[model samples]
Every structure is written in structure tokens, then in C-alpha cells.
Target: MSIEIESEDVIRLILQFLKENQLEHTASVLEDETLVTLNTVESRDTFTKDIAQGRWDTVLKQVSHLKIPPRKLMDLYEQVIIELVEMKEHSAARTLLRQTEPMFLLKQHHPERYLRLEHLLSRSLFDPKDAYASGMTRDKRRQIIAQALGSEVAVAPPSRLMTLLEQCAQWQHQQGILSSDADFDVFQTTATVESKEDADALANEIYCTIKFPGKNAYAECSLFSPNGQYFVTGSVDGFIEVWNHSNGKLRKDLNYQAEDNLMAMDESVISLGFNSTSELLVSGSTDGKIAIWKTQSGFCQRRFSPAHSQGVTSVCFNRQGTEVLSGSYDKTVKIHGVRSGKSLKKFTGHASFVNTVLYVKDDTCVLSGGSDGTIKMWDVAEEACLYTINPAMNSSAALAVQSILSVPLITDQVLVCNKSNRLALMTMDGKVTKTFSHGKEKGADFISAAASPHGELIYAIAEDSAVYCFSVASGSLLGETKISDSELVGISSHPLSNIVACNDDQGHVYCISSK
Candidate 1:
């Protein structure tokens, strides 16, 4: 049965117990702190006194006036009848048994017991000791009634706090979200609390600007190292530069040429990614080549030339950094081994250029988005297409997907942006949970979008040279800021901080941080 225990009732019970125990000083202090006053109820007191004094008529009248529960009234009637018989007041007990509803309820629910009580009325003078033979004392019976009344009137049981905690744990477990090692004590720690100062600092305005040189050789792509210590940018001039992200100082010119032999640079670097340890860097080029570089030496360790029939557009390392997945304009996605320099898998079926590709479903499957306006899931082990999603197939306007990014903190959803000036949060199975649009008037065609580290926000760069922020959960537009006067070509979020770096077509990079 559901029970609700009110705070006032609990305080009153404590005060009543304290007063009964003669702890006057402590009771007064508690009453002062809780602002509770002990007010006596004359009618309730009279009803109790009448029961103790064997005044059946008065007890019945008070119970009827108070509108007590039928069951409780029946219990009180049973107790009073037994008491009346024990006191040899048989006539009074018989009169009450005939007049009350409790007699009818007892007859209906407990006919044998009702018949035994009825037999008591027939006796001229029964032994008083016989009625008291049940071994239950009057004080114990009164205590039982009081306990039942307390439970019926309370808002919740005494163990409500523990019950709520258990429910929470069960819910988390059913959702397959709770860690096996987590316990109730985790809630009491400061680790669960978010730092408002750190949040404000991360949300602050653009604090640093990392400028790239060369007017025509703008950066095509930018990525922050997984450790967040370095930022790397791939330029249209075929040079990849790594910078100390915090200070904007050049740490290594990864594409610098030596005197004896020139570093391989057949075309502009379009995509770049760092492994989990930040020890290996991978870059895809327009010449259809994928190169793996040793980060410490800035030297190429493995190269997969003609990785695709057309230019490689996107590339990323899997969770272990042992495998690389890349998408190409040739309408195919390929996975390559980092050490073996061998193609592990190739997924085809995109009607148009594959714009982006990544490992999903615990690196067991690949998700790729194409310019053909379709996203496909491929089973890596089977080398077969599992599902294909066309986001704009129902619309009259053709929409080419520009970018697909994994939503941080959410495992099943990804952020998708298309040329239709629309952005959608979609599930791995191709279901659109929420769609965001600039409306037909704005004509804001998105170039790219990045998710915050916490996955609470998404930042999209549109053709208007403005960056728009949105809430990931509700798909609400949070705000917008103009990052450049010209079109922005690429945007990257810091892996470990609330820092966003965007590169413009004019070879300028702006670092934005939260305040």
C-alpha cells in the first residue's frame, strides 16, 4: 500500500514522545527550531478516554462524527466489545453490537467470529476471565491501533529514502547505463557536481586567435590532439602544422621538406586525425593517398597510395588507434590497418561521393554519410550494407549531406548537416529524433558542425560566415556568433576543453572559449 508521511506529523510525533519522556528543555528547543506547537484535540482525547472508561455510546458517537475508516472502526469496536465483556458490562456491549455498522461488517467478513460475539449477548452472567483469555493486554491492543492509524495518516514510510535510492539504481540498471561498480555513496561525492566557474570559463568569448600564413593556402581541415595539448591543421598548400594549442606556438612542421629528398606532397591535405595516444598522425590527401606519420619525428611511417579512386575526404582512427577508416569522393569507404599498411575492408554502394566515415557500434560497424543524401551502416565483419538512410528522399529539394559527426555523451545518435540548410540528430538506425532548420528565409547552408565535449551543445558553421550554437537534447537554437567576415572552411573542438577553433578561407584560425 502506498503511504505518505508528512514532515509536520513526524515532528509532532517526536515532540509528543519527548514530552512524554519529560525532556522539557530539549522539547522546547526542538519546538522553537521547527516552529511546531503541541495542540491537544479535545474530541480525540474524549474518544480515547471513553473507550478506556467503557463508555460505548460516547465512543461510537465520536467515531461516527470523526468519519473513521470502517475497518479501523470495526477493530475499535471489537476491542471495546471484548473489554466490555471482560468487565461484565454484557448489556452495554450487546446494545452497541446491535446498533453499530461494525457488527454488520464483522457478520459479513467474519461470520464465525460474529456468531461467537452474538452468543455473548445470550449469557445472563458469563465469567469475566473467559473474555480476557486471548492473552492480549488492553495497553498492547491500544498500541496496535495507534500504530495502524499512524501508517494510514502518514505521507510515506520511515524507509522512504532508502526505497527511492533502490528504485533509482534499478532504473539505471534497466537502461543498461549504470556502471556495475557504482554504489549509493557516489551521489555523496563532489565528483558528481559540475563546476560553475569552469563552465563559465569554457563558455567565455574568443580569447585567442591562431593565425595561419598564406592568403591562398587556407587550412582545409583542423583537429585537436586527443590529449588536447596540440592542435594540427592541414593546409591547401600540402603542409600539416602542429601547434601548441594553448599558446599558438608552432611545435612541428609535419610536412617540412629535407634537402636530400622532398616530403611526399602531391596534393592538398584534406583530412587529418590523431590516434588516441597522440603518438601517430594520419592524413588523407586529394591525390588519393593515406599517410601515417610518427608524431614525434614528423616522418611518414606508412603510406597507402591510391587509397581510393578519387580524393580522400575524411579519415579517423578507431578507438584503439590500430585501424583507420576513411571516406572518399569515389563513392566508397575503406578501412586500413595502421601498421600493416593493408586495406582491411572496403564498403561501397553510395550513389554519390562519400563525404564522411567513422567507426560506430563499438568499432564492429562503419557509418558513412554521402553527398548523395544517404547515410549507410556497414557490417565490417561481413562486408555488407546493413542499412541505408535517405534523409531527403521524401522532400522535393535534393539535399547533399555535408558532414556527419558523432554526438559526444550519446552513443546512439549522430549530428548530420545537409545542403538543404537543415541539421538533424539521427539514430544509428537512420531514425531522425530531432531536426533543426534556419527556415526558408535565412538560406543558411551549413558547411560543418561540431559537438561540445559534453554533448550538451552543437556548433554549426553556415555559409553566412556565422557560427550557430544549439542545445543537443532539445534541438533549440542557443545563440549565434559571427566568427569571420568570409566563409569558414573548417571547425574543430578542443578534445579536453570548452575551446572551439575555426579556420576561414583567408587562412585565419579563431579560437573561441567559454567565459
Candidate 2:
């Protein structure tokens, strides 16, 4: 009643179906009008097969002139390479490998896949089936294959110089020490950095030094209002200090502790945020709790625990200020309704502690970065993870990431920080378009970055007690200023040209003009 066709008959049927479906018209266009006809039929076949399998090398070898759409190529490669690798077709894979070096290099960027590819390449190079002459026994062939697959690539670790530099950086940061000279332009300066010092003297002549209380190390700070009327500072001392930016005046200081029953010295405020209208201030603390306060009256409005079992590292209010997003050491990002102080949805995807969370484009989506060295884009409205970007994996040289700050230069792209303090420009879909660094000063870990709404320039703070102005178009440091007695903490840009506001770790805020 049923018939099973042979492989040859199946191929014939496939060809017939393709022809009847008018797929031949598409295939013929490649041969008739396209440059693909320049290559032999065998080469074309191999190339098409490779393209179908994501063997970019084969297709590129037979036809490199044709502009291969990047998205299509990636999709094809993801589909094919994964299938063939799972099938253990090492020889066939090697054929594709020999044609494409960039594709191989890209795969090598992925640590896990790199190891597997190395094993596959090693096996293909010395498999016993192809190693010895004819008449080899099954056991002998199996042994050879095992030997081939077992071989691993030999690579040397980083040298002493690299390790020493890394050690120096960590020691400097932990001790709250800043380097004297900037290796790159647009360097951030500290209170110790005088306009007369080295590069600081060479770059800017007239700059202002923002002096802080220097009483306690400020953990973080944020703009008090969109109009830049005032700024708020939070510290490990469990206090939220507000300062009037119009003139140096202490406006208010708000502090609270869990009821008398709970007392802990480790309850430091870690992050701060403001609503869209800047009428409310939200502070996250080391106690894994969030406190919202009325900015005008300095009254504590609500207290939220939100089920976070670890310290909240970062907090941000959505565009409308109706909801708030918070990232914590518990490896989860939780969204909370502002008015009700109710937990909305908890995004649990990061394998490590999340360092920062940001609302993107009118709160249509949110971007979160973590110690796991990944940036995840979440659709808040849909409650779905749109995509993830691992710039650390693609980078050839970068330290393990310490923090991530997203600066939306435009509505289309989101700029995020990689381990090297480099800005990785990513599309909304999570594809990294480029990696850019400003002020090239080595050891200049970005404490904060703010892009102007017009997308012309960006203002950033370096670990040092300085501020840097960057040209977003050229990815170059435009101008810099040295601020004495202030370790740069946060930065925010005016909607227009380079007018910027910066906050220091010492509870000080200053305004600067780039003109």
C-alpha cells in the first residue's frame, strides 16, 4: 500500500517540485544574470550548499562580488553550522572552514564554540580514516579518530605586563586612588588633578573644580530635575543629601532605618533615581530595599522590599515614571509599579549579579547589564526579553566587565559599556554595530556617560576626578576639565549642545559649558 523511494528518486522528486514551484526561476537568475555563473557548476553547487548550511567561505569563494546581506548570512550560518557540528561531519565542515577565515574568527570569539571548533579542526586534520593507508581495522580507525579529536589547541596566556597593569588598576580603584596622567584624551579629572597638571594643562585652560564635603564616600548621585535646578547625592553613610546647584547650599538630608527592631551598619545607599517630573526621588540601598521620597517636602513616601534578597545596585524610573526598574545582586531585574509600590514582573535571566538597569525610549523597553558580561534587552510592555548582546565575548581584549551604562545617542542605537570602558553601539535588535572608546585614557573606567538628545556630543565621568566631553560622531574626546576635590560620579547632558552637569563622589555637583 505504501512505497519508499530511493535516494536517487527522492532527488528527482525534489528537483521536479522545485521546478514546478518556480524556484528554478530564482536559481536560474543566479546563473544567468548574477556573477555566480562565472564559476563552474560544481563550484556553484558547493557554494549554494555552503550558503544553505551557513558555510560563508564556500559561497564567498565561488562568489565574493555579490553583497551578502549580513542578517541573512548570520541566519543561514546559525542554521547550518549548528546542524553539521551536531552531526559530527568534521571533514565537510573543514571544507567550509578553509574558505572562510573571518567566519572562523567570529566563531573563535565565542569561547565555547571556539573550543569545539578547535576539536573539529584537529580531528579533520588527522582522522585515522584519512590518515593511514587502506585495510585498517575498525578498532584502529576508531583509535585514530579519538586521538584526532582529543588534541587541543595550544595557546599562551597573557604575559606579566598585562597582569601587572590589571593588578595596578584594581589596587588603584579599591584604594580610591586616581592616576596623574591620562593615556587617552577626554580624560576625567579628580580634585587632585589641577588644570596645571600634565594633560589637563595641555587640554583646557579655564575649568572649575567642584568641591564636595569629602566627609564620606558618595556611593552615587543623580540629577534632581530635568531643568537642572538641584542634584541629589547618596552615600554609604545611609544618608541622601540634596544640594541646590544654583549656589552651593545644603538643601536637605534624609535618612531612615528599618524600625527599631532592625539595626544594621551595612545599610548603605547604593543607587538613586528621579521620576520624569523629578517630583520624586527613589533610593536603593545595601539592605535590599528601596525607599521613595517626595523631592519637595523631603518626606518618605513609600518603602519597598520587592523580594530582592541582595543589595540593589541600580534603579531607574520609566519614561512616564509610572513604573521603576531595579537591578540587584540577586541576579534578577525587577519592575515595580511606582504608585502602588507593588512588584510588577521579575526578569530572571542573568547568571550573575546585575549591575545596572535602564529604561529605553519612553519605557517601551529596558536594557540591563550584569557581571555575567551580557547586556539584555527587555520589552517591558510585552514582558519579554527581546535579545541579548555579549560584547565581551566578541572583543579580542577586555577585562571582565565591572559596570554597564547605556546612553541612547538616538532612538535607534543604545551605547553600552564593555569591560575596557569601550562603548559598544548596538541596535535595538541586539546586534553590535561598533565598539568605541572616548578619551582613550587607560584606567579611565567610565563611572557615567550621558548623550545629548540631539546626538551631537556626550559627557562622561572617568574614575579619575575629571570630566570629559566626547564627539559622538567621530568617537573622539572633544574637551575636558579638571575638577579638584571631586571624584567624578555621574553625568547628565542638556537637551542641546555640550552644556553638561556632573556630580562627584564627595556630594558635589557642577555645571560646565563646552563652548
Candidate 3:
């Protein structure tokens, strides 16, 4: 009986030891399955609370004193740290995870979000922790992008274009997420050019006028050049005239007069352009033909007959001057090679007669407007319709977009005319930064628009025979010139001058100086 009492007491002491060490439940459950009910939900909750509230620190310190493997302790720390981080208790969360170092898991699950968080943390380390400060940072970031990418380019269709814009928005969203402060600074910019120029100093201006010595009336002129030195003008007189605008001298005038040909209408020269080297003049006439004329000497180089059923309205030269694009009253635009003068491509998406086409730089993109009251972007390379410049919601849909002129005024911004007595300053991506409207004048129609060589001012001529100037940045009307009683259908600003030249509905032209 004495031996039995000693053995039972020893067992009791061991049981108490296990309980103090937090292994009592496990030991008891292992001894008899029926006793496992002691490790019930309520008991487990109490145990976990004790472990979570610093009681486990003492137990962990005691465990450190034991001969346990360092790896096992690290595993426990990782499990606990992951739980804390998942619960938004990041500080404590980081402490636990750092012990085990599960960085790969964090990076894999959240790349962009984690990047943003990292940015915020870095910012906070050097700055104050004001949440609103992030707003200002976000604005600054946007200003930087807007300043750098001042214009947006329209590449694909409306759907794809929307996707690109959304990416920009996403970038902006990330910036907002990464910013820690909102009240840092506001930036102010100054104009580079003076607001006024002395009248006497404006003598270096250019004065251009269209003169026709032909029998047929000079209905209209599409004036353009490869090099500014020599400009080519097309008129209703069935002629394309290349002039030395550099010194106000006539260079070469080539007439494509039909011999005794019965089918030839050759009504007039409606649109014209010069090849890159200024060696070939491409003209689209009232008759359905596109004619290429040699520049060095007046001669017919080649002729293309994708022939508009109606009148050809506009023609343009691609940046390389290898391709010629024409828009016609038959509601089609065609692309042809300069060397062969053969139709290489054609665009027929416009519902109404296509009026004007502008090739953008060396890219295959083209901007076209027509009587359909729509301005469309096309990729001549892909032969795709990218998108249409959405007409302003409040404006009349009935207002025809008779013409469109795109002047790359700034690096990424284009100045445009829509024939609605208004001008639009837009990004290549189709975002309108500003619009200038010529309020309703009884008989006025905004016909022509051109950007100054310096890109500081934009000049526009109205059918009411008035030429107006506006500040490109501020959109303020700077000046105006009233010249003729007939409507001014065309206008060109001198590359080196304050002088503006304009043509009227009657085919007469004038040169006026702002001075």
C-alpha cells in the first residue's frame, strides 16, 4: 500500500506539470479518447485568448530556454504573423512575418496594390502622415503627365481608344493611392512670347494671294506645300499652279486640259498638295481624276482613275510624300502612290461626301471630315476606322462638318477647324482642351484655320470676310481684319510674318497686316 500511494502521487505531480505547461489537454486526450471533450470550444477560446494577450510571451520565453529547434519557433512565428497581417494589424503583422520572411507570398498575391502600398510607406517615412496629402500628390502627378503628354493620339477604334484612356485613368488611380499628402504646392506658369509686337517690326511678314489668269473662274483654292519655299494652289480653272512663295514669284503652272476627249470633264482643280521633295504636285479635280504633275518642269507625270463619280474635294500628301490621299463628293477617300499614280487604298466609311483629309506626320493615320457632320480618324496602314471625334452633346447634329484642319500646334496637341464657326484645341487622343466659337453672325461661316509657325497664335477666316486671331493658350481673341464683301473661303498665315492672306467666295485674294 505504501508503494501504490507514492506512484499515484508521482503521476499526479506530472499531470500538474503538463497542465502548467499548456499540454494538459493534449496529454489527457491522448490517455483516453472519452476525456477529449475537455478540450471543447469554450476551453479552446480561453486558451487562445491567453496565448494572444502576452501570456504566450512568458511561455515562449520558457520554451526558448528549452532545447527546441529554432526552425520550429520560426514556423510558429510565421503562422501567427500571417494571421495578424490578414487582419489589417499590419505593424504586428509585419513583425511576425519578418521572422519567417514570406516576401514572395506578398508579392505574388498583390503586385500593383503592393507597389502602391510600398510607395506610400516610402513617402510616409520621409513626410508627415496626412491622408489628404495624397490628393495633392495625385494632382501633381496628373499635371506632370498632362505637361509631358500634352496631346493624346487616337490610335485604334472607339472601343480600343476607350481602353487606352482607361489605362491612363488606372495610372492616375494608382498615383492617388500612393500619395500621402494633399497640400504641398500649386504650380504657376508664364507665357514664353510677349503679348504685343511693335507694328514697325512686323515687316518680315508674308502676304500670299491667289491669282488666276485662266478663262474658267477660279472657284476655290487648296494651298499646300512640301517645303514652305514653294506652294502649290489648285483652282476651279482646271489648273494646278506652283508658285515660289519664298520671293513672290511664279514657278510652274501645269494645265491638264483635255484634248478632244469626249468623257473628260476636268471641271476644276479643287484640291492639291506637293510630294515630300516638292517634285510632284498632286491635284484632285471636279472631274473624277487625280493628276500628278512634275514640279521642276510643268508636265503630266501620271493619272489615277479610281475616279470619283462626283467631284474630288480634297487631296493630301503623306509625310514621306510617297502616298497621296483624296476625298471626293462621292463620299470616299482614296490613297495612291506618288510614283505610279495608282490607287493603292481607299476608305469609304463616310456616309456623306468627304470634304477634307489631313495626313498626320509619318504615321499612317489620317484625319477626315465630311458633309456627314462627322470627323473620322483612319489608319491607312491597317485600313481601319479608328474613331470619330464626338460632336459636342449640346451642339446640333445637323451642323455639317464641312471641313477639318489639324495643325500640330504643340508637341502633342492639334488645333482643329470643324466649319462650325468654332475651332477646337485637342489632343491627338481626341480630348478637346478648349474650343473657340464665332458667335452667330447673320451671314458668317468659319471656313479656314491655320496655326502660326511659332505655334503661339491661331488664325481663322470666316465667310463674312473677316480674319480673326486668338491666343493659343488663353483662347482670347487677339485681333481681326475685315477685307472683302464676299465670303472668305480660304486663309493662310505667313510662316515668318504677322501678315495674313485670304481668298473670297468670288476667287479674289488679299494680303493684310495686323500692323
Off by over 4 Å in 1: 1-193, 200-204, 252-264, 440-442
In terms of TM-score, the best-performing candidate is 1
Q: How far is 264's C-alpha from truth in model 1 (Å)? A: 6.4
Q: Per-residue lDDT of 254-295 in model 3, one digit per residue for the tens?
A: 222222111112667777667666677777777778877665
Give lDDT: candidate 2, residue 169: 58
- Considering only N, C-alpha and C atoms within 3 Å, which residue pairs clash in candidate 2? 184-440, 184-441, 185-439, 188-466, 189-465, 189-466, 190-465, 190-466, 191-484, 191-485
Q: In model 2, which regions exceed 4 Å deviation?
A: 1-214, 217-219, 252-266, 381-384, 393-409, 433-435, 439-441, 484-487, 494-511
lDDT of candidate 2 over 459-513, digit per residue (tens): 6667766766666667776666775355676665543223456766665556564
Q: Which ten residues in a row have the lowest lDDT in candidate 1?
A: 254-263
Q: In terms of lDDT, which candidate is stronger, 2 or 3?
A: 2
Q: Comparing candidate 1 with candidate 2, which one achieves the higher lDDT?
A: 1
Q: In model 3, where do residues sit more than 4 Å from their true spots?
A: 1-216, 222-226, 243-265
| Candidate 2 lDDT score relative to the true structure | 0.58
What TM-scores do the predictions have?
0.59, 0.52, 0.54
